[model samples]
Target: MLPDLAAMSSTSFQITATTGAFPLEAGTIFTNTVEVNTTLLGDDPSNNVAETAATVFPLLYIHEIQGSGDSNTMPGAIVNIEAIVVGDFQDNDGDLFDTDLDGFYVQEELADYDNDKSTSEGLFVYAPGATDVAVGDLVCLTGEVGEYSDQTQLTLQGDLKICGHATLPAPVSLTLPVRDISDFERYEGMLVSFPQALVISEYYNYDRYNEVVLAEPFVDERPFQPSAYLDPTTEADAIDDAASLIARSRITLDDARSAQNPPLLRHPNGAPYALDNRFRGGDMVQDATGVLGQGFGIYRLQPTVAATYIEENPRPDASPAVGGSVQVGAFNVLNYFLTLDDGSDICGPNLDMECRGADTPQEFDRQRAKILAALEEIEADVFGLVELENTTGVTPTADLVAGLNDTLGAGTYAHIETGTIGGDAIKVGLIYKASTVTPLGDFVVLDDPAFLDPNNTGVPKNRAALVQTFQDNRSGETFTVVVNHLKSKGSDCGGAPDDDPVQGNCNLTRAMAADYLVDWLSTNPTGTGTGNNLIIGDLNAYDK
Candidate 1:
């Protein structure tokens, strides 16, 4: 209500009212009218009433919307803000579908920053069709705040207005090995730079997602496999702690593209990551700068500028020399099954188990070629193999030996024939170079009840051991080789011996198998009475 005006002179005044919880959706206008009462006389009655219109919404800063927590405060609220574009991932390529995220990132200008460490001043505006904006452009837009895949974002509801251009904000500097894994949440969707040299720790997703994990090198050395250093049974807590440290120290370096198996891969040095120019796990990337983003439960750095890549860890051309009269080696031939994994259940000994490994003829050819090259390079006299298909017909071991002989003359290599040693879908195998070593008496197999499941059934849980004695041609020295495949930690056992946080699942079962092996070998199971023994193959347990 307006105050009464004196006689013929009129004065303007102000009114403050709250538009509590405007219920309409975004872009809707709310109007208000003011009228003069009968007590207040007006010269013209027609001019007594006046109305004003406004798009009912709050105008908030980026920090206010992001809040000081992991999520947004006004998630479903419609609001307006003006900020400068930081990183633009809009689909500029004329593809039918977006190759990257069809949106852009905007951050508050340095002058307008709220100066709050806990709240982020940058935000991702999910405008898939936006076209008129670029980096450093000051733009005002009305949008509804929302959470997409645990990330706070904005969806445009009204026309975005481009104000004048502004200077780009400086990116915040950060270091690896943060105190906690959640420490990255504060800088989510913001521009950040790492001033120190970081090493590539893992590239498991590089082939598929154009991404590689970067982390602070472990004590200035390459990251070692946890299982190689710590015992999963005794040092379980330490192993878990080391894993947490890795999680806190690492961040994914993405190509800023969303396409899988990109035709042209990108490297930090502005070069294509090709077969010749590849990056290993220990390569270093210096002074990396990018926009930090969270998606699919991973924190990634979408590079904004090219960085220097140092090839500190080059690919090894040949295997290291061990220097001995006879060389013995072990390899895990991961699911080397001739039976195709083509949605059929006609593999294994019973002919009813599902097959694994290559799914097509083309894939099988590629797999065989790589395996053959690796085996030839090892140059070992005797090799213990794991994960071979447990089928009755032409075995994987026979196929591998044939491929080897084709490369290195005929009668060069031979494989032991113990038909389908166990009931499991996969079994262990042994192969040797016939020219270097000769087989002794019949190969022995430890197929005791200890390998069976805890229910005392005939079904074996661990694959039976493949034991053989070999005599070196030059030295005439005999050594018994025992190959084994123990129960893995991937699944659980029933009851009190299920799984240990320290050693993982099936710890007791594997321990029991180890005990049985020691007892069986003590009884001279091979009957060669050779005290010289060598135990090998996938024990499925980590070394201390």
Candidate 2:
């Protein structure tokens, strides 16, 4: 017995005993059992000996063909490989049948058969629109190893055989807070279970793709520090931590159901998990057993079993009205518009594509329902509304008022009309319960330097604030309420001098607007001759 050749390349090797001292006939084949060592010197010497016939074709494992290289492409030709089907898209035993990531991922049955952590034991089968196989089926396949996008997957060649059903491998236990980008490759296509519950942080793509981003905890983060510390290092560190948490601690949960906006959503208990109308950002989830999949630059947890959902944030009831004779309120109505979302220029000065509200009448109806609910719940006598669609009509503000009053009664709520103020598609308006308060005069809107421009933000740096005097019908008490939505820090007046090193975008404009607000409020802009005022609105330029 000798030593192992660094390692054996094939399953079988042969040796001949045609010694140098003796010559054999041309037709003679060596019959001597020339022993070969298949182990290292450190290994047992007696157990190292081997005798076998060399073969033309050799069996290859999935990892051997996959190799350990990080590059997408495999260098050598791969004849064939075998693995059990951990994923073949047959997991849908019931109505749920979603496989949006496409392609099945096959992995070796036993855990770490070759004991090489550097190489992956699993490989994705990139045969799209082909789904004849079932999960847990053992398979032997011949394929051309090419990378589809960045994923190293096998494009099936010749005829593949599903040997039979077998016990699927146990799922790998993986936890969250994946700090590095490359940490997910090992678990790709492998059955994995999250160790702890993940909260649903984003559901904007819920209806579109049945996709939800889940984090270990809530991620509805606020931008700026509440205290005015203004420390650069602290701010940078906080921002970095926040950014990392957003990217690192999330897994995209893809629904197994092929349907969109399924009528019945349930918890793991098989009861309704109804967190608000849809699963909002704070809903907790657990018992998510899924195949880790990647496509289009997103890693999706394709659930083998439906994930258990806990309604962390339930549907909120209407807010209790504050006990006051003059009930003044401020509401941000996230851009309410009446023009049937035809994408025509709602605001004359803005581009037609600037339409940001509901894209359809049905959508508008849905949005109107929510706004109506919110306002009616507030039950405020005086309401200063912000972010209404800027358009000129006989009653541009009437649509919302009509929608509100329809819910609260025909004569319940009415809003002040300013026609069209600025060119931008969003503006502020005033609304009040007619039974509770009366409008003394017309709603006043300003486009001056203080209200609109600061650091010369090219016209309206701030939304045109509307000032209107409301008289308490019973007590004859009159006060002013101005609704102002200032320039937001995001993409605000983004020119050279306007950008602040510490305060960031549009801070100067907001400061100037504040100064102008104080001076203008001193004079009583609406001029009921009343100094008693309630000036409340969002100063958006202060945050990241």
Candidate 3:
């Protein structure tokens, strides 16, 4: 009679000992006992299994035949059966499972089969030596426990077979674009480098030449002083190198004495020297000999080197009264050139040196010619000229006035020099004919008095504002004209966005000047009949 298997529950058993080799055949069952732990079956026993492994306490049945040659096993028989571990088994065979085809294995399948089974859980069964058994191959797995190694190892109950080798999904791809740099060609002359950003502080057209110019006044950090150089061999060099030279040297007094004596006099008649003719006003003297001797005491020495000078003289042939209207002309003479065209050999081939090699005679001649031409073009009763230099240390103001009065041969002209600030040689001035407008005297407005320090100061004299007042001779009207050249925006003007109230100190100064002028005008009105008051010059600010 068949052993009664009806009372047996479907259960898992661990092979206590294997009597034969692996790939156990059907009907070849050895004596195997059902484990006391019920968790030895199913995919992930750590998590509660929906169905526990069948219990086979009294006896177990050969319910199904698995593995090679296991099909003939009879059901309900107490067969010492070799079981086939059939289900989803992944091994060396590439047929049963594929990642590209079946997708990834579920996480539950890879978890421990039971809390007590360490090595058996999440372990896949595989047929060794199968083509799909290569390293890096992945496959699905399913099996039964044939033997046990303490609490860790698991042995196959039947033939370990391959389900399939997994195939990896295809890799992903990407793309990116390139950039261009063509527009930077125009900035070639600026001495700029690549991948850099340069911020311009200020840009404007200079009124004289009407040439577009850029200024970065913020760079002016300190006063400009001429660098002193001395030759090592000369006796005068000893004085320059003396230990107490800066303090004990009497260059000013020595300079005065040198001016009194001339080694070679310009006048052949042996006449007494006129100060104006004997020495060019702004010339500086350098003596090689340290001796304070007799001949040097009696006669002045000619200047070894003259100061850098530029001059602008008014047109001698100007006739503004004929037109009955003032025409003002602004020109940048482009260094020291009297004429717009090339004439003298001084400049040679270079365009920058228009009046080169010009002696006093040539300078006078060239200046007269240019002034005549400019006056004819401007035809203004009043004119403003900037960037003028001259020999008298008086600048171009007096010379221009004198020249115009002499050449026009009609009306007398007078001018007042508006001195410089910040050690700049360039000064602005006004030239007008006495026949059209009478000079009413002029005064200078100084920069804030609070900036003056007794210990340290800039450029000797403080920054000042020059204001000149005049009267219209023809109309008998009084006009107060305030001429100004305000501080430029490039320096210490704070930064953007300009709307911020805290920044723009230079703008504040300009505003202060404007307000000061307004207040002055309010206090000192022109004449009774709505006096013709005009405020002019480079205000250095944009009109609101």
Q: How do these models rank on TM-score, best leading? A: 1, 2, 3
Q: Which stretches of candidate 2 lie over 4 Å from their true place?
A: 1-99, 111-126, 138-163, 179-181, 201-211, 218-235, 238-247, 256-281, 294-299, 312-335, 342-364, 384-387, 394-396, 446-469, 472-524, 528-544
Candidates' C-alpha lDDT: 0.79, 0.67, 0.33
By TM-score, is 2 or 3 better? 2
1-544 in candidate 2: lDDT tens per residue?
A: 4445567554543344332322333333222222333443354546656544222122356676566665333533444556788765533333334343445678886853577665667777755455467788887766667765456777765456776777888888878888575677766667888868878777766655667777777444312332243344467665555556556777888764445565555333233435543465687888777777766687777776666777787657755665767777788877777656665654433444356677788888898888888777778888777888776552446877888877778989888878777767777888788998888877777677657876764566687788888888999988888788888877747665566544667877887887888788898777683887777767674433
Off by over 4 Å in 1: 1-59, 77-104, 124-144, 155-168, 204-211, 223-246, 255-270, 295-298, 315-318, 392-394, 443-465, 485-516, 539-541
Q: Which candidate tops TM-score?
A: 1
Q: TM-score of each candidate?
A: 0.75, 0.66, 0.31
lDDT digits (tens) for residues 15-70 of candidate 3: 23332233444433233333222333343656433333333211111222111121
Query: How big is the positional error of residue 147 in model 2, measured in Å on the Cα after superposition?
Result: 6.6
- Which run of 10 residues does model 2 get worst, by summed lDDT? 25-34
What C-alpha RMSD separates each model from the true structure? 7.3, 11.8, 38.3
User: Candidate 1: what lDDT?
Assistant: 0.79
